[model samples]
Target: MPVTDVTTDPEALTMTLVAEFAAPPERVWQAFTHPRELARFWGPPGWPATFTEFDLSVGGRVAYYMTSPKGERAPGAWEFLAIEQPHRFEVLDSFTDERGDPVEGLPSMRTTYEFTAVDGGTRMTNVTYFASNEALEQIVAMGAVEGSTMAMNQLDLVLEGLREYAQGKGTQTELLSDTHVRITRLIEGPRELVWRAHTDPELMKKWMLGPDGWRMSICEVDPTAGGQYRFEWEPVGDTEGEAFGFDGETVLVDPPRRMVTTEHMTGTDYPSTMNDLSLVEEHGVTLVTVLIEYPDRDTRDAVLATGMTEGMEASFARLEREVMG
Candidate 1:
């Protein structure tokens, strides 16, 4: 199986997370359905999970409790609706009270987990449905999306580790969080040098990937509010690549200081997720902060799972060389 892709639509209040695991669908199914295996990798890093009850059947109930490092505990329960062994499952997940009773009036989410064979492994998708768009919006605004993405990334690590362990390769997978992969590099060069590297077409070509099929095409930027920019990452050789392009609307443009862009990826054709870049000077060092806002947690998680931190580090290193030279 290949890497998974996760995405969300905040306006629609929906999220979809897809991943490919190096295991058969049945194995993956067992990992998700079995209480003992599920408890081991269910929560975010440092969060301990205990499954009080898990009934893997339609009309049955599954309940669990999670305690953070600080000793605070949160309980949740789920009612299974459809259960097809090793292939698909549907359930309604909700918060529970101390007595193990479901909390009334709180949002209960409907979730469907689907598994399919791809290559020699399994392709799994987790789709969560909220009651209403308003509820979805509220949760996203509260950062649930980002937090969930982090959790899924942790799940990826767990699944990968399990696969390796099954093959007698390693002991366990290392737990990782979103912050671990986020990039924050302090630059010593002037702001203009940094800005030019990001904005200038010639300089961008040296670093950024181009569009599919076309080797190198035109790169343009308006650099002002309401302005647009284009990015292309072309394919090499015979293999076809997903077209890499975005038409972004500039929301903020404070040259030598900050630039904010709202970009919509081509496939979704949705509103732009916000990207904010800020340059601040402290004791002669310029700190660059790149903030990207996605539609939901799943989308953010998918990006983080990809080795984004390493990629950013390399790109910044190249930028450093270009600016210093």
Candidate 2:
């Protein structure tokens, strides 16, 4: 497979990959829309794979299990949001259990794949949404960006293999920006508990917020559009830090459904950070997504360089422990 263009803007944590495959739109579409075909190239290489339940309709689900080389098996699921044969398919992807249950405190992302017909082939593009800029960075640090690129490349290989088996000429594969991080996780807990962990200041302090030295002076939420919120984090360590504060203006706040906030730090003159949270309930479990958008590439790169990814993963792990207990 040949990649025509692969562009990655680490600041926006966005990646665009453009590739032309030798097959027509229908063939490419079948490879993606069909669950059996998808499982062949969906995960990292050398992982044992199995599909549990596959329903291709809107609101339907596709669940599968993958066992690593060490014999550790993990289950994952995807909820179909939209499916247009031979053109586009959108789904919410996450890691789940054998019974199709979501785990706790992990982010679930929205993934959309589009197929277009070219002169003699098909063009495919994949767009993924993360919960927060921090979450995206964390996934990048964990190598999701590279893993996904590899997965896509493997998809190209699968296409070529299919062509070979069918006695057709093999084509190619490509990438646009390969910088974006693919974030997906399973959160296992009741909706109300997860809601409390998010909105209740005391509870949030226990998990979402950092420890004693970096305490939050104020954490108030109106839970409505045009509502106001202020969160201040002060450092206590001996090391000279950025020595700044954090603030955000709420743009959209719909309780237990979704919330969007524009965040600004004290030193950074620009209100460059956008935070988005979404919550859903499945079989009594609550799944949440937190998306953070930065002002530009520089700020995004700076934050990534500061080990923010590990910090976020720790915070989320704390939240899971607190809630699951």
Candidate 3:
């Protein structure tokens, strides 16, 4: 759906904006409540916001600063006046000094944020109130309308990212132990669709590439327990025989639920890994957890340090589009 409006009424001393996001209400709420998530898209296109303090309860204060590319900074704060979980909240928004304290003699605004769950996503309505028409005009002259529209556009991107995450398009990597590294994602789609993506060769080829130009060239899956599988990859324009690939032996298999395998990369000096893939269905979403056991802590750390997580996230994002589409 389109934005309803972003209008400022100087007579009423109010400024309001409206937008919709392709995410659930709770997901949209988290984008506001979670500090790290809020920082991702809380400002205009160039000036990005960084939060030093974020507390969502009533009477709590949130402090942040927006840093421009030319090294300028604008500090601000929001004192939460009321909160109603995933539905609504009200805050007193103000200008702040470098120390995160409100600046004296500066006008502040009271803002109410209302979130409504819609059929396909969430509708966000924001209303800001100033003490006087002059105060509203002052901020309006500061490009509040344009800046907020840009910020909300960024929020649209953030909500799209969150939607993918909610559909299992995001990846989480952590050290389960000194030798075990766990990577997990809650993927949207049915269990069989997820299973096919894992086991079917053609579907695997669709999303198994690391970057844009790379390709998963050879995929073979003999999906039973004790079966063997191989996946080979190369740059799209590769002319040489050199290719990066992996082979594995399935140790256990349970359709749409669990699969255990030993993964051995063919061209790497790194240690082979044992992966336990578990898929559980809850509310029509499949939670896919992959626990990978490296030979030692050093090997696991080395893998992590390679910055492979970004590639995994990119790959999974494509996977969601391929499967869910």
Candidate 4:
């Protein structure tokens, strides 16, 4: 559910996808570069993937294939051009024949993968460049956009499993008072990065999402005091026209330090709430504290009963990765 945006620019000859995972850079990196993990999520839903070769070093080459439900196999290869551990890498990917050779006259793309450590997780931005605008259009017309989106969605699920196996921990929440609830975690990055990720809409879109099959369709943020922000979540799948949205006004803002906002969720019966977010750095990590205060005890209890904490925890976990890289 961490895939926030997928876009194509024929004029720029590029296809870009921005996603975040609730796992550290190292863990996310391994999921991407390791053959076993890559095979688990490289294909879209209903397609099984198999990786015959995977080498992460510069000049390395990888071969893989995805078997469709009808048993048809589509093969591909990656010619790695550059690599930086737990951060970024570049590769030239292309379709391959049965012999593992690039198909003649087929369009190939040079992909750049950037991994950033944000709060406690990692944000991955993938940009694929074609040799020409025509080549970009060709692939876009061939359903690359839809296929890649589904594939990345699978990666989000894969990351959750990987984190559970490696960390053996789930998100924790605390009820501090009758009207206040708090969620705190030590994000694996500097305070500044966490601050920017929270305040900037571009960064926020990389991770903030609604429930499964739903995404933030609208995001507008003005981070200064007295400024306002808005977010709208709409079902991206077959939800039969269901949508929800929210907006907020910034009461106060201090870079890398503190922020106070008054938020309202539309189409909901609960009253507006006040949110206080504070960030502090210890060693090289950032400790993020979020306190939510409802208008009254009943309102707080009503909101809690709606299962908001689970979504909030997932959002924060993804936010952690958005800032770390």
Off by over 4 Å in 3: 162-325
Residue-level lDDT for 57 in candidate 3? 86
Query: 33-118, model 1: which lDDT tens digit per residue?
Result: 88876775576433446799888778999989876433457898989999888899999988899888877766778989999998
* lDDT of each residue in 63-154, candidate 2, tens digit only: 88865423457888999999998799999988786677786766677878888988878888877777677766665677675556656665
Off by over 4 Å in 2: 2-13, 161-325
State model 1's lDDT. 0.66
What's the lDDT of the predicted structure labeled candidate 2?
0.63
- Which structure is stronger by TM-score: 1 or 2? 1
Model 4 alpha-carbon drift over 4 Å, by segment: 162-325
Task: Estimate every model's Cα lDDT from 0 to 1.
Answer: 0.66, 0.63, 0.79, 0.77
- Residues 161-245 of candidate 4 have per-residue lDDT tens digits of 4323223243455675677676666666778888888887888887777345677778998988889989988877676556778
The numbered model that scores best in lDDT is 3
lDDT of 3 by residue, 1-325 (tens): 2366899887787999998888888999999999877886687644567798887889999999986533468999999999999999999999999987788877988999999999888899999999998888888889898778767765664565534444534788866468766676777777788888989898989997766778887898899878999999887664443578889888777688667788888766666788877665655777676767788888888878977788788787788888667
Off by over 4 Å in 1: 1-3, 10-12, 156-325
> Which pairs of residues collide in candidate 3?
167-188, 168-186, 168-187
For candidate 4, what is the total of clashing residue pairs? 13
Query: What's the TM-score of every candidate structure?
Result: 0.49, 0.47, 0.51, 0.50
